[model samples]
Target: MTDLPDDLTRFLAGVAPFENHPDAIAPAARAIEIRYLREGQAARPDSGTTFPEDPWSLYIVRSGAVALCDSDGRVLERRGEGELFGHPIRFGQQAAPYTVQAVEDCLLWQLSAVAVRALAERVPELEAFLSSDPGARLRRVEALRTRRERLADLGLRSPVSIGPDAPVAEAAARMAEHQVSCLPVVVDDRIVGILTDRDLRGRVVAVRLDPDSPVEAVMTTEPVCVDQELKIEAALVEMIRRGIHHMPVLADGRLAGVVSAGDLMRTQSPHPLRLVRDLARASDADAVARIARSGPALLAGLVEAGTDVTQLGRMAGLITDATTRRLIELAEAELGPAPVRYAWLAFGSQARLEQGLISDQDNGLLLDDALDADGEAWFLELAERVCNGLDAAGYVFCPGGVMAKGRWRMTRHRWRETFSGWMAEPDPKSVMHCSIFFDLRAVHGDVELAESLRRDVLEQARSSEIFRRFLAAGSVTHRPPIGVFRQFVQETGGDASKGLNLKKRGVIPIVDLARVHALEGALPEVHSEERLRAAAKAEVITERDADDLVHALRFIADIRLRHQVERLRAGEKPDHLVAPDALSGLHRRYLRSAFGIVREAQQALAQRYVL
Candidate 1:
């Protein structure tokens, strides 16, 4: 190979996909051709008359800058020094959908498609970085920076087992012999129950049971089990959320091993668990608020670690659940126990287990039908205490007054009647209420009351075709903000005038689409992804369409999360607004594609439901 210019070689050595591979820098430099353009020059004109038409080339802005514009000349992205452009053309696009123009006098380095292909063949990392798929680029970054260990990587040994018919003495003897604290009770190679030291001490030894009693007599049945493929961080989250010390691990539907809290604690950070524990022991609402204040910081750390978006949401939900439960406990202690059985119901994202850092309170109180006027007054006081406590803990009061304090705190019969009336009327206001209240889950108190209400809601919604159509019509109105020629339609007023409402314009459209299908299929799922999957299984939507919607939802959610984390780290309150210009060229393209997917799903929904 011929010697390259010294300056060019040095610059190439500093660029990514080449900086780490010093040996490839020289060859890459050899293939480069330098070009210059005056201010206001179009690098690739719409007529394709400025550059060679045979083999497209990639351009690196060595100095000055350039703007990528849509067909009508609206700026899509601005590229500066060290940033590469014209990747689409080199990656097999017959012609670029957007034109690249020099925003100022520029110095550029250009490499032909053939040479770029040769370099990619030699460097696998370069291949992934240069791929057209945004997911490939994301995966490369995650693998290099934030790849987490899976349960299998912990080198867990096969669990010691005891047959369900085995005597209590034999089980204890086996545990002592193996130095294990828990035993999976197996029958026909399946785990039927679990026996722990706690069970022996609390159930058998404490009660003075016979030593010859069968293991199944005291073992806890239907124990929680985690898959061997689960990430260490996720396993720790589950353990902390459930307050369990030992969890059985399954591989391909059979018992593989057992992971204890100690095992996970050694591998993962103790911050989240410690926070939950502190919340549990919190003496007052102020103490709970103080401990819960660290939630955003904890979430920022998780985002920095490249945790999956779904898991990030799950972590946030856990914090909110713990805080809410603690506040309820404190309130009950102060205001005295409820005069009637009631369930503290969570609506919207919290109930769906997809809460973000910028969540508000959306809850109601479901009281037993046996309540009288005196009991109602008592429950009202309880509701006020919990709502006020939540507001003080940073979940601000709902502007729409959807909290449990007022009309929402109703008896079971009233709730049922309200649901029935909403379905029967199918008016605009009723449809709006159905959207929020239908996605309810019991966060605390009598869960049976919540479950009963859910069943009635589902049955009524299933039979009411007109109500479903009204819901579909209402949902289709929140379309993704994609304009003609595939550009982002940004918000145009107030504080978010320069950005797009990612939560409303991007995430909620998919959420609504999945929800419509879920209701049509009578699915019991609350989470959007779960609803999509369940709808697919019920044949309410094609599997391919379900998968596409899921991918779109995750991609948009990931971008939104990263954006919020950035704002949070900068000491600003996080919101759903995101400026298109703030995103990298690659992310902009993928986000546009995600919005397009949502639009297509909405159109299909409109046709199917005749909205």
Candidate 2:
């Protein structure tokens, strides 16, 4: 321990993947060897190379330069001494995929494969850095293997255009010939409008607008556009938010090309903004309903795009909430005004922005206190009509009828009174309601009013140790599935060997723990990951522990999204059920390690909550 370098020791801490391995530390430190690249011994592109079975080397350039090259003499990437390389070859590859050449005299750390493995066993950080999917591997062998460079090769082509003044018939013909769904309408070299197939169906065809009329008359006047140099992720987020069918990609001042939702869907870019745009464009409850149903599909795309799980859940929830609100808005327009001023509160998954492909409506209303018997009658009727409308459109009613129509959940003052009573003397039932209602987020109407109630509840919760205890007890009720004998516990039922409900067991524990922490700390943040981080920063939880929880949640969320995609492709419904056999050997190991992080977080939560 005295001989070990501080850099090596510091790097080993909080490495979740290999944290539990008994021999994880010493072997890593002992096996690493440092060597200097000879002054003139420069390797080059297409240079002949020696093959080794497992003398895996960690090449850290100490000085000068090095180039990663392919057999065709193509220079792949250039690297400096402070950077590490050769990760791809570490897993027992007989030959390196690309040759590494010394551009000048250099000092290198040639950590042996045996040492790397030993280090991985000892250092969770090293193990995670080394153990990545071969197909998905793109670690820094050189600085040039960047996403920006990869996107350039994707080569978005220049888009075809038409003048807004051009006849609709001519524009339609051009669109048909090009076999594209959209065209940018330009006027005097400036883009003025955009036209899409949906617009054609909804407006032109439905209204029987003459095709011979000017395209400008029917074209969407304000088109959503993105700068060509913007990252694909940014662009996708924009598209989702705006609910546009096409985005005109502009480079400098010129139109480069167009990107559509279909193009993005096919590529599986983790652009939640695009989904937002799709939701925005939804014209009716039925159309919005269909688009809302694609939440899991969008989530899968986000996972494939390598989105962080925190962001993934946040985006997913936002989309779902938006759709639900849209349905409510449409219903209000169709039916009539609510009997009084009311705040529609989305409960459970929708409130948390955690809805799956198939989710039931879990919403209730907060009505103004002016209501008497007549007002009550009006609200009851309104709730029934809106919920029925939502059901007809797609969302199934909550089996327990937790909607606004419920007599127990109808009035705003009653809700406040209920919270006050629960806080006065916390019980199991009170704690359960807090668990559900604490996660409440207002989706539509008088948001400030909904927030006022939340503010009141948090105020009462902050001072009550008993209330916090009940909340913590409820949170720890669902234990992580780590086994008594082995480090992990797998399924033993019909789907035994298939993955357990990662959400229910691993992720939700963290979520619930975070929720408890938030309530105890009196934090107002609604997102679970945010609540956890905020709690940690406020000294309610440790920084190291928070980091573990965040990473574990992201890893598990990534796995869940991938499995959801597989199910969707197989024409099966997306689910929390994951088949372990479907996972690759590497992924299986990752999944196991990821869950271990969850276990640690849960244990920490239990200790802190006094559960």
Off by over 4 Å in 1: 1-111, 122-148, 165-170, 173-179, 252-254, 334-337
The global C-alpha lDDT for each of the candidates, from Candidate 1 onward, is: 0.82, 0.66
Tens-digit lDDT string for candidate 2 (505-599): 77678778888888878899877768878998898888766765666666666677667777887888767767655664334545655555555
- What is candidate 1's local distance difference test score? 0.82
lDDT string, candidate 1, 477-565, tens digits: 88788775455899887777978888999888888888889999888999899999999999999987887788778878888888899
Error of 2 at 152 (Å): 12
Candidate 2: segments with Cα more than 4 A from true spot:
1-126, 129-284, 298-302, 305-308, 356-358, 392-394, 491-498
**Among all candidates shown, the one with the greatest TM-score:** 1
